[model samples]
Target: MSSGGSTALKLNNILIFGLKLLVSAGSLYIVFSKNDMHQVGVTLTRIGPAAFLTASAMYIVSLLGATFRWKLLLPERFTLRRLFSLYMIGSFFSSFLPGVIGGDAVKAYYLNKDAKKLSLTLASIFMDRYLGYVALIGLGMLAFPFSLGLISGSPYKWAMPAIFGSFVIGSFLFFGLRLGKRFRVVSEFYEYFALLKDRKDVIVKAVLISVFIQIMSFGAVSLLAFAMGEHIPVKMVFLFLPIVSTITTLPISISGIGVRESVFVLLFGLIGVTSEAATALSLAWFFSSFVGSLPGLAFYIRHANKPEVKNS
Candidate 1:
């Protein structure tokens, strides 16, 4: 019976994978069907030696941010070089997974081997993920109006309010739970607040790292725009890219191939750039990932001999 159940589960996953592939392919077809491949080539051709350097800079900056953020999460004994290696491999590892794994499992595994505390490891991992969301929220809401002026048609018109509401509701829950714990009104909520109280700086560092990560991604798009000869404001591009990035990270498409291009096309076109240009820009953005992954590949090659992390 167990064998039968396992087989059935495998079949279900296979079916789901098939459907996701179809949807991703169909979306890619739709996006490409509307534009000229020749023009995309032209756009790529226009990117010269300087663009490569710009892309390298963007990738390096993002890599540094990830390294720094991960380092902050570790206990003091861990060296920067060790954290850097793990950070690079873990990030590259996420790209290989079906969804954005984002290094939590791999990272936690190594940290646990050293610290051996389930709570500390888990707390830091959750805190790391939480900080990123908080930062993303800060970037969107705090600078919404100024950023909106960058593009002509914001495809994500609901983006600011949606993220804003999430932050507000989240903040309320956080404060409400803590209040309940401190006053002994609802001692049941104490565990959650206790976690926070024990680790005061995790949340702050996470928020800061999240902001840094968002900025790196936002900066990439602006550089792409610059490479493509677009003169849009950095603030506007920063806002729209994050919203678009959230859409791309949805895991429905392969590396967000079609969806991101579609969003860029619609949003940029509304701002008077031709669909061809928008398509070109989006394609450039997609290929840039391959460039960014080069260092990650090198890091993995050097570190594969390490033992697998025991799960907490």
Candidate 2:
């Protein structure tokens, strides 16, 4: 709240933004140096409009699943329809804004407006995100065997160990929450975990919904791959998408601009996919996701004039 704190925050943001831009540009440069721009452009041009539309539709359904998962975590004060709109607004910020944090901030703003218990509401949001990620890794592990053959000779093949390592670490931390009761931060997180554990049925339903959301995301990307004349296997998609999603979450790029393309080019190359086609697929996924998030902008604008109430 102090001027010095504000200045420090601004400097930190500027530094982060600069780093992201540099990383995005650097990754793109590396990818482009080894691939043909003209061919990639050609591949983009050949994609069917129908396929793109269908992918976008699938993305919309995935958004709904995401909303449902979050709703399961909330109390009776929030409705699914209302939460879905908020989620879209969050998505809009995520797509147009810089990083993952902004979107969640937006969601928090809307939820906190009507929430009588802001801490619980915030905890629900955190759990919703955590469960979704858990579902992604769990599904990725399920698809790992199929993906193993796909990753056999890629330069980034070590990504396998790295991914599993993260999962293992995450598991350890979740269980270790009990050991941090004296720490304020970990105590709050542990309380949220306890809240979820009390409702085993809700946890099950939320995880299942999260899995469906992942499937829908995979379906959207797989459709684009098919449209580009590259019939990507379902299991293969399960493997690479989680990795791509995980990498993009690093906040080292602007919405993963160049990072996604580079990962696609690297991994798809092993499966005989041309760099051009792979880039096209990545672009298609981005467009569908961005389009899906556009309504969030409208929602945000409409909500802008609404009066805000202080959290209770």
Candidate 3:
């Protein structure tokens, strides 16, 4: 495209983006008006500083694990500084956009250009996520059996199918490396799995770290609930939060706001928790996550003087 055409497109995008921002601001206002902010504030008052501190610690732990994980995925020749910066930016970006695009794209772009093994880096990042989700399922299973008394009576009784399916999928990924002839379905799967088999020493370590990240995050949420003085057991989050997190990870609702709020209320409602309380907790979790990314805005500000690889 010509320079003039590129400039025109850029201007058009800016206008569209500004319009979307206005729409989002308006929507948030509407949602806020309809919401019971008084109850939300009351609930917030119930939560103590210790809980906030724990959540902050949890954020640090998660961010550290992600940075370390990305380091492992970096090409042998890649710079650690670049990988770490990307990880920080990625964590910050994930807080904004729905799903994982913001951070995932940031990491993919940087790793592709710098790592020199773009495909492997991509596969590693994805597999890292796959393991993280599977670990969450594992964590949830550990939590659910004891909380069966809380969950068995709810609509979440459908969890059997979900758990069974996650197991089957995880098993397939673990053992599917041996398949050769049926490579067309997903060649990357074969290669990545094969790499894992060949590098069990490294792969196992990465998976463990991913699991730890999930545990810390789950603990963080439960800590907030506890600090809020809710009668709900910590064991309850272990049981249902993984499922909720997994649901929110789905691409349906924006940033998983509606889906997460609905799940928090629905799942915890089994224990007689109020929908308002659920909404408050969910918002708190999101607020912490968004606040945690303030450092990313710092990074962007520092780098503003340099030419940006604008996402467009």
The clash count of every prediction, one per candidate, is 1, 0, 0
TM, every model: 0.79, 0.91, 0.78
Which scores higher on TM-score, 2 or 3?
A: 2
Off by over 4 Å in 3: 1-35, 48-50, 75-81, 97-101, 164-167, 170-189, 301-312
Clashing pairs in 1: 131-206
Model 3 residue 215 lDDT score? 79
Q: What's the true lDDT of residue 269 in model 3?
A: 78
Point out the worst 10-residue segment of candidate 2 by lDDT: 303-312
lDDT of each residue in 45-125, candidate 2, tens digit only:
666778888888888788899998887887554677778888989888888876635888888888877875566667788
Which candidate has the top score in TM-score?
2
User: What is the Cα-based lDDT of residue 154 in candidate 3?
Assistant: 70
Which residue runs of candidate 1 sit more than 4 Å off their true CA positions?
Answer: 96-105, 108-123, 147-156, 170-202, 306-312
Candidate 1 overall Cα lDDT vs. reference? 0.67
In model 1, what is the error at residue 219, expressed in angstroms?
Answer: 1.8
Tell me the tens digit of each residue's lDDT in model 1 across 1-312. Answer: 699999999898777667766767787788789888787778767767677567656766776776677567655456667667666666666556534344667766666676676556665666556667667767877667775555436556667668668667877786654554554434433454465657768657756777888887777767777877776566666566666677776767665667888878876665677777778777776566556655776877776666644332
**Clashing residue pairs for model 2:** none
Task: Give the C-alpha lDDT of model 3.
Answer: 0.69
